[model samples]
Target: MTMTDSAPVAVTEAAAGPEPAGAARWVTTNDCRIVGRAFMAVSLVLGVGAAAVGVLTRVERLDPSAPDQILGGLNSWFQMWTLYRAAFVLLVVLPLFLGLAMAVVPGKLGADNLAFPRAAQASFWAWLIGSLIVVVSVFAGGGWGAMDGVTAAERDAMTLTLLGAGLVIVALLSGAVNLATTVISLRPAGMSLLQVPLFAWSMLVSAVVWLFTLPVAAANIVVVYADLRGRDPVAFGLPESPGIWGQLDWLVEQPAVYALAVPVLGIAGEIVPDRLGIRLDRRGAAASIIGLFGLLAVGGWSQDYFTAPADHRDELLYVGVGVAAVVVVLAFCGALADAARRGSVRLQEMPSSALAGSALAVVLLAGATFFGALRVIKPFELLERSTTTGVFNAVVAAALIGTAAGVWHWWPEILSRPPSESRGRLAVLLLLAGGVLLAASDVIAGFLGAGDRPFVGDYDSGAVGGLNAVAVAGSVLLVLGLIAAAAAVFETMRPDRPDGPGAGDAAAAGLLRGAGS
Candidate 1:
């Protein structure tokens, strides 16, 4: 057929928009940004909440006898459970959501919308419900026993089991949903796996890590729950074996932290080069990714040795090797940074939030590396018996501070607008002041050997006073950030009329006029 004959005649319909579909309106393929923004909002809240709670726990440790009822009653078990719960939410749940969002949102990704919107929605609801169940059960007061006093051995057993199982379910659902979406829907046409952005690569690796590690963590939680409930956990068959579960928990948690760190590292890799107006060293970036995954796999083996028997020198040696691997990973990070510092890589125009967040994450990773060295290289005798000391408190503080700062630095990008500067500045000041006061309390209390004292009536007056002040200061920071974040959201949604023709408007109009000619 001739070309003209092959071209079908077209009919033009009236240029009317579709009728409103009410609340049941289906999101089109072009709505990836909206889905991504929503996911990020929820993830940020969970992450920040976890960090704030962790910092408070650290402050409490600075002064064990502190009168300020931060989470109520200075009970060790209560504090332990709360901190563990918070850590799980932050490390596991938040990262899972972040991976899913990053997989779907960016323009480089082929996704027009979330790969499986229903699955994404289901994952969110499942995670929320599972988290709530775990939290509420803690306050139920029967299965877990009392907060002020020790629970009956029976109650302790039941409580741990319930919490662990709930967390496992949440982790499994999140990992599966994320992995499916990333593999099936995120890859764009003509883009090879090698060509994917560093962040997306990290997410891909993280999902695989989750697939392997989360099941192990879940198994460990189940066994621990059973042990707590006064049952013989080994009765569970095959995959649920208690001994294997313990080994896997250690394995999973070690790499899991790296999984969280890698994405932030990738974000740094991308942002720094762009901000400095130079091209990133693609080979260096790829090397960093490979080295990170290798280190994560090896570093994970060390957690098992933490509570292993003193005679297990072989286990200790294994841990040392893992530590060495981590050192290598740190070196890779240094290389990446050095490349940026040189003219080899430059960051083009990038958001301030990206710059801040990426910088803070790198700092946090550095701090983690320092502590890992201490824990690994120190004499086993000194490390094993040095529980509940000021030094230990310092390590915890470093981790908490690093994570919190990183989270805050990225808050604006995640929220899609600047948070109220007044509130952000106030939070920064309060965090600094609170950190100082808490550190001071630790010093004073240490001088009095408060660390050796029992949790009862032995009170370090100076420490108690200092901790109370720190708690108050930290609370202010938390409240202010929340208020500012809320205000930013409200302001963004408010309608406003357009001003006179600006650069963006003029450019658009010019394009339209040219098209007419």
Candidate 2:
């Protein structure tokens, strides 16, 4: 296939800016790898901090604890919980995914540099500065739970914080355009649409979604910012409406948020073939699934709309909703299953395979649970009751798997070396185990009540204290897993580390060898 000519890029910095002098290169450099690494580094630091706070929040839920002493009283407790989630979604989830894309997508398109390297850098800085502002705001108790108390200063800070969020999305918007243009215009010889890497294809689709939905997100943020500024409540949609694409989770069930999981599905698709050293079982089918996912993503946003499930079902919304859910869940699961079945998949030196395998398991289980719920109750109620958090956590786990595994799989290609294999595997397993335990606890909570990651008072922990304890343990394990994963990756990037495995690495390897294949 011949490549088509794309319109001229603006190239704003190509000849316009003063060159950086001396040590500023490392920080201000537009090299995709450097920028990507910076993004992940900031995310890692914040994720570790969030984990500590999150564990404390979860621990507070244990029975017989003094309410005042639960993570430094109620205010701080709420702050910690709010910050924990913000860090997870905005910092950890987003930056990690963006970093991987910036680092990997260029090579996927057979290009030497991103189409807008400087724009990628801008995306990094904008997101960083904006994220920092929001982090400050949330930590200052400018979050959802902070509304009960009215302080002029706090409210103003939160308004800035929401604007910061809008700015962050704007930065991401720039990245989406940069990446999409790069992939579209820079493919190497004979590369056509179907011939592109699954990750690259998924990123393109995700970028397109961002283009349409981000403006809506920004408008919603504007309305919220207006409300915070004491303007009339610009209630754009009813509280019962589905979240706008991925960001809308509060009002309706959160399958929309799982839209982020589509690219993750593509990442896993790429990993399976590389690990197995074979061709993908159904390349066209996988591509078709991705397209189906994209359509379902936007179309299914308000599956139940402003009304109840029964009303939607009467309008035939139930069938469409079911189809969308099944596509999102079954499409990727089926692809992975097909690959594994056709290939001699095994645990090799890299444990990322294990991580990807675990991811597929959780996604399948989560999807099956939804289908089972469909038989007994309305899909909306099923998700609203308790299954939402459990399923969301599982899908998040799968996304984590996709991100970590993609990094691990492409590390040698990108970094020209391998990381601590044994340590990485341990981290992957810990995360998977943590995800399973946490999902189970959420399922138990579903029998108790409904909401997304509510704190001590959100649900009746008195009746389900044991289940809550399991969840606490799960949180601890999950955080430790993230710490381990971060350490392995960062250790590889250190300046003077030896190429070979160390004593701890050797011992871990031997332990694994002795345990089994």
Candidate 3:
């Protein structure tokens, strides 16, 4: 019998099974969908907290003269700065994408589930616990760096932070392995890697990049943790300064930062073609462009934590990669545009949150790469300026936009219902606006001579203060946007129907039935 003939029974039986109760349900479940939803939900909550912290940090920047008033002290201010970056990347955007991938990629690959379902569950819980520890440690006077001298208690907190960060990284890596294995090993008969859907291909590429890059970060955390626990702190775990941030900030900066946006390209690739109801023009070229973009984003060699900045950042290779990234993004955008040009240009039918979000994500990524390329020019002197923060903001915005698009597009599999189109569009607009403002203001402030350091907000330009104020406004918008998006997402999550039939059920069952056909 065809898989469809059997789906009702399969879904009914699946739904009728006794459900696990309380903590056991969440902790022991091997369902990728549940695990994925958990990742996305937690990331949204953390995103809001990070945005609020961002607002507070920028508010302090409004009056560089009174830096400590808002956050209470320079140490606290620095803590918020590093904490914001760490939390946003680790606890928010990366997990957001990874979670969605966990839910979506296996089905895309025609697999019944992830190759390592239990590992996916373990990864999520470990990531969640580690994320909490990271946040609590930061608020408890332990963060990536301490501007002032640290007390014994604070030192111990820093150690905890390292451990949490390590766990988070390892969890992410494990999740990546799950995704990569599913993609590589589970495609149906006659479907080569090239024949996979764009989203799946993009995920496979992203998984490889993460495997190559995040381990370096995990290694950095390990080294820092060991040094912090040693008799004497070394160059990395220096007592009372920005040393910790210096060693780890590379994750959120150029080349490496683009790693987070790899899936943005994939999301756009999937959305545009699907929304247009037409095949993408030059599909092979599109796939090649995505792969090239991923290649450029591999940033393991770009970290200069232990070496002089010039030794790595000033090298031809660094500059070439920085500049090449912009071209690669533009190429993918061109491919997308070509597809749209060939397809029927229906305006009313278009403009769904998914399409808008995808378009905005590509634009934001392009802007980010442009800024990154500009920073490589020694004359711009923007490498150590707030322009770095601009690049950071834009890249993150792209990821956020992409994920929003994915959420809307995959709502049936993800949230088990169609998203409110109006609400999704509103969230996309708010997020895009906030992201643009934050990135542009930072870039302009850097040109106006604002340093990269958050505490050094006293740039001579009064305009810099004005820009900081604008960033504060942007942060507020980000918080509101996140709330709107979260409400739209979580409100539809049926608490009582934990095992409702999902969009994936039929596809999963079909794959099982036709495995050897």
Candidate 4:
């Protein structure tokens, strides 16, 4: 008999001897994998939308004087805000849901269902509602991606507060679910923390980070909302004050970047070893974890420099630089190189996911180095002339590209079928070409030029010209590649029936029999 045919018989045989009264309970775990898949699908859509907005922003800056065509009079400033808001929702909200569901699901966690299944259901519903509220806030009578005109300032204020609170609750739920599942459900009799998969470990670390950071973010949002309504939120203090609340606001904002990136970093680490077919090195993994935590702490402290006294600011800058160089830069690079080498040595066949994730990791690491330098050595220089704008753009581009590549690498396994080889080749070509164009643009814009007074101009001239061209081209390529790959995967994974009794009917009957047994 074929494997599909035998699968039904095996399930039926297992079910024929069941005895426990509640053993056959049709629990919420009925569709964990499907739920996980749907979560990932939504995440991809949001990610692509956010990236598209970013590309447009770059294009608008490249040639500001051009007729307001793209995005309907969408200037760079407005696009920046849109990108920021979109990114916050995509990066913060979507990932939280995906990560939580993945953690609590049956196979990953080995749970019959989520620890608090009702809470799990509630979490998903609450997150959906909260996400809609935040997204609607963007388009509530304002222009596309506009936020300034929502007339319900009080309502908007309340919604924002509710949204943040909801996010915190979601984060807490993720932490609880992941922790309980990892400790109680996912761990087989022999599995220990060290034996757990790297991806699971990464999820665990990210959960801890969320546990600590989300409350701060939620509290600050509440305080900000209160202050907006002419209420005295002196408990949190003003931005310049010395109170813990002020410190908390600064604390929440700084680590927010890492809060998003760390999970991605963990995913990269896990994928690299698996794709390469190498055993993950425990020491290297531990070092990477430590480095991530150290950087998170230092980065959190550095946000105070924005309003801090000169001496305190200087000290924080030095600390930040040290952490970046010693902890984040050197440590992560070392771990990545070690993992890559091990994988290359062990695995004869390298999948696209492995290659793409490795490359993207390098790009992000490089961007992080640049960001560190910008923040520490010449903060005033970049801020005064807006020279840092290019750096910011570069960082965002690298991040989005890296994220896309990582997602593509894992798409086949996640979707249960390989994407079309033709589309895969096209994606590779588009990404390479786009990278080349963006590089050329950077060089032409005099990014490396040495001058006391930088000549930053409008999008009509200089680097903006080249940047715009590259941005538009890259965006088109990226969207096309993503859509093609998604279509191919969906097509390939569609159900196929054999010339015999349908598998679903057989499987369903077998399951019922097993339950009755």
Q: Which 10 successive residues of model 2 have the least lDDT summed?
A: 237-246
Residue pairs with colliding backbones in model 2 are 243-248
Candidate 1, 37: how far from true, in Å? Answer: 3.8
Off by over 4 Å in 2: 1-23, 63-68, 72-76, 145-147, 230-253, 299-319, 346-380, 413-416, 450-463, 495-517
What is candidate 4's CA lDDT for residue 466?
A: 56
Q: For candidate 4, lDDT tens digit of each residue in 432-474?
A: 4444444334433434331211222322455445555765676
How well does model 3 score by local distance difference test? 0.86
Best by TM-score: 3
The lDDT ranking, best first, is: 3, 2, 4, 1
User: Would you estimate the TM-scores of all the predictions?
Assistant: 0.65, 0.80, 0.92, 0.67
Among residues 3 or more apart in sequence or in different chains, the pairs in candidate 4 whose N, CA or C atoms overlap within 3 Å are: 15-514, 62-459, 62-464, 63-459, 353-409
Residues 68-125 of candidate 1 have per-residue lDDT tens digits of 4565664433444343443443333444345334433344465544566555555545
Clashes of each: 14, 1, 0, 5
Candidate 2, residues 1-517: lDDT per residue as tens digits?
Answer: 9885653453655555776755596567877877777777777777777777767877876743453465555555655655665566666666777788888888778797789999899888898898888788866746543413435665566677677778887887888798788778887878887778988888888778656666665766776676666643244321121121223333123434455565776777777766656778778788877766655454334434335444443334545554556655576677677777787756564445434544554374445336424522544445444455565556556566666676666664334235666766777777777767777776666767634445433556565677778878888887887888788878765433355543234345335433432
Q: Model-by-model lDDT, in order?
A: 0.44, 0.63, 0.86, 0.46
